[model samples]
Target: MPPPASSQSCAPAPAPAYRGRFAPSPTGDLHPGSLMAALGSWLLARGAGGEWLVRIEDLDPPREVPGAADRQLAALRAFGLHPDGPVVRQSERGDLYRRALDRLLADGHAFECHCSRADLAATGGIHRRCVATTRRPRPAVRLRVAPDARVAFEDLVRGPQVQDVGATVGDFVLLRADGYWAYQLAVVVDDAAQGITDVVRGADLLDSTGRQILLQRALGLPVTRHAHLPLVTGADGRKLSKSESARPVDPTDPLPALRRAWAALGQDPAALAGADRVTDLLPAARTAFRPQLIGRGDTAS
Candidate 1:
């Protein structure tokens, strides 16, 4: 005999509040490209009357510059882009990631992977399954993306987006071979823990969204809204990255860079014409910001 069905219908859960975040790697000082993303995220959060949080992605110690995280936070404050709560650091949250990884492994949503770069070179670097004949003592952990798995979501800034995760990314990493948590796993766990309702960052990370979404589903976490701002490029038409020695923005004088970033977002230049300080400029910019007006293509810095 089966139990009687409950009278309540299985409706979807209510959406969370408008909580947004700006997460930056502590690789170097805040540069034009990074500042643009920070400002864009701050404006969107302020415009929507939401809380804006900051997180330092310092999981990769080898790549991180000493004191870069503190400098980044200082620069953001100079630009009047203050976070609503205490800043979260990925380095301090390893246990959360470990628990999530354990759950995925227990549920068969993830597996231990022994394959290295050379092993999957023939497959164009996409890991479908374990290809190594010999397993290392410390193998990496990867999510088991099914062959037919597809993720679709509406990007707040880029509009409707879809990605075939299995075919394109195939069994992405959750933990690296060096015993470090991968960005996909750390970000998914932190976002859910922080109750992030929106993720607004540079378009350079747009491709990683699908993997994060899949991880969220596997972990039974809420998927946040995404808005990827256009990437800031250099004269060579390449993305401005901290690793390439992109010029860092001066915190002492932030108006020029702020205005330039505002223009890059396709917002009206006149909107910030009379503003002389960061405080005055940020409110005006927030009031004038229109997400629909942001361009899809990368902008020259």
Candidate 2:
């Protein structure tokens, strides 16, 4: 593995350099919504001629089904989304995560807390309470956010935005009460660890981007280009979820889904009518992968 990002790592990490990855948590079968994200992220990295990696976000194995990650990979293969590097599994990197967490805790960037869902709700969501109350460690680790500090970053798709992460997201958790690695800490370390210079994912993760940026800043790691695509909601106007029993993506027939996703993104799938297979569709997308070409309105799955 390459060396982890340190004080000597490049500032802002040069564009069209380093790598990008699609880290999917295998809670269930891949769905249309999931495929859109994979396609978008894959195209983003490929268009840049950079390395593309795949990672199974299986840190929370309790939530992971027995064969879900492999099944997800099978779907990606069927859809022709191949990675340039070996796939990484979060479950296999526990030591790395533990080291990162310990560093954050020792540096005063994180602390131990026993706040439960109800304990946090009682204080209007962990805001202002962390400053006044000192709770003993029962099971979780919470990051320390300066109450007045603001985290600002630019989005390639959504443009410039600013958030007082400390106030808005509150002092977030790094390790959950159940001992699972929190998405915030895991993703931050993983991005730097993976040498990702660009992060292209669904827009629903926009809020989390600020927190990731904060963690990067704290660690002195380089910031990457962040682009959050328009969310793919369901017909019911809700986020399409595997838990809600969203229709499983048919890996055998990725064509229909690809066409539908293009339409959903407001792109003209018929523009390349002769595209009959995965290889043909990918080339078409790479040639026509203009972010501005994506329609401006919201679309539900």
Candidate 3:
């Protein structure tokens, strides 16, 4: 991902003073990538004098490993990132999501589908799954992806991103066949509900931007700034992810890890040295933070 700024004539659109959140699925512990995201987002919000919040994206129970949320919070604290308010638990917001689904259904922006992955994989993931099913159970909810649906925006870092939501993502799931609320739906609901106006996140989620934009349009949520930083990858060249057994960031000893991560990302960790307190660090980051300090492709930073 290209860095957000150039060293010359910087005219950054003000980082919104609205609330922002770092929502991580409880499928795994926080890792280096997670820390980078937490650091960037936390610093951005706090620097803008806005609320920095955390949300536990734990709506899917089968995929969620127990205690991952606690480990994640501990890791953030170890990194000196303290959230502004109590964490939001997606699992506890089922009624909210269900009500949203009913609203969307009544509004005709979404439809129910009963297609299996094997069934859709045959049609290159675009064919309707419930077209043949006469059942009224409404197995899963999918945004009725318009054939020409394209979402475009200028990312704060990776500028000029344009993606076709219907083609790249197809009629994406808002709810799963297993009765679990999907990530895209839950995330959009939470971000709007929480008043998030800036999204400083990993490049792995770059594609999700198109779908999220669609959700924002359907739900009439405010447009948030998007900054997609390159994701950290393993030695194998694959992007680091929870499913890959990536080593979790140490929640107890965040300094060494943050130091190593800063150096790894090519950012000068010493810039943040001699801080008065943990809370002071974020202000220092946002004030002195130069988005152009690092390049694309992350081992860190």
Candidate 4:
């Protein structure tokens, strides 16, 4: 077996470099909505003269597509969104997450629970009751949340934000009974591992930011600044999802989708409409990119 990861390896990376990342799950192809997230994060990093990276969130094997990771990378390249460093995949970094979980358990910040979804739902959608119990075949690890753990942060685009994770989410899971690492734990660990200083993604995940911040504090990791851009919804007013049959961006002719994505972020596309390729369009977009330009509410463009 390989050597176990040390505490240093799991801790937040030292700062000074302005690092940002675009992490996407490989459950399906890169749709227009996904492209918007990719573009927003890319522009923010590149515009700040910082390094931009990509990490494939391929931890959930059951929902992952067979060849989606490669396809997603190819699409990003076709759209002229290249990373500054080598790509990282969550599936290959299990040891790091395991080490972090061990630390949390050893520090008495986390515990094992066997509560099922039905059980949590009956308890007002929280695992508070089962936090101290360790009964059952395959138990999940949950973090002990303090009732007054109210986290607040300034969002670059949306202004001030605050949420009481302990009151709302309550002793969230770190690892599932099925043995897959929960997103809250993996995301916090990876953001620190990648030295991410800014998190630019769609507003759909804004609610979960509080939980992430709480986890970061529990792990003594640095909390990254967040900028949640407007989400692109369908005709039904629902945010676009790959699982719901949202069409993926056309790899051969990504210009149209790119233009739409640019506009969806509240940037004017007329300035770059004459450009033929993503390479020709990014320079001007980077010059004008700012999260504040994106308006509030779901964008239908």
RMSD, every candidate, angstroms: 7.1, 3.6, 8.2, 2.6
lDDT of 4: 0.85
lDDT of 1 by residue, 239-284 (tens): 8883353699999999999999999888999999999998899888
Ranking by lDDT: 1, 4, 2, 3
Task: Give the higher-TM-score candidate: 1 or 2.
Answer: 1
The CA lDDT of each predicted structure is 0.87, 0.76, 0.72, 0.85
Clashing pairs in 3: none
Per-residue alpha-carbon lDDT of candidate 2 for residues 164-249, written as tens digits (9 for 90 to 100): 88777788888887778888887887778768888877777888887888888877788878877776777777767633536888
Q: What would the TM-scores of all predictions be?
A: 0.93, 0.89, 0.86, 0.93
lDDT of candidate 3 over 88-205, digit per residue (tens): 7877776667766777789898987877666676677675435543443657789888878888899877779889876667788999877888988888776776667888788889
Model 3 ranges with Cα > 4 A deviation: 1-16, 128-138, 242-245, 264-266, 273-286
lDDT of 4 by residue, 1-301 (tens): 1233333377776654578889999988888889999999988888778989899998899999999999999999999999988888888788899999999999999998887776676668776767333467888999999877789999988899989887888889899999999998999998998789999988989988999998898899988899998888876667887235478899889888988998998887777867886788888788767666787777874
Better of 1 and 3 by TM-score: 1
- Model 4: CA > 4 A from native: 1-8, 131-134, 242-245
TM-score ranking from best to worst?
4, 1, 2, 3
Query: Each candidate: how many clashes?
Result: 0, 1, 0, 0
Worst 10 residues of 3 by lDDT: 2-11
Worst 10 residues of 2 by lDDT: 2-11
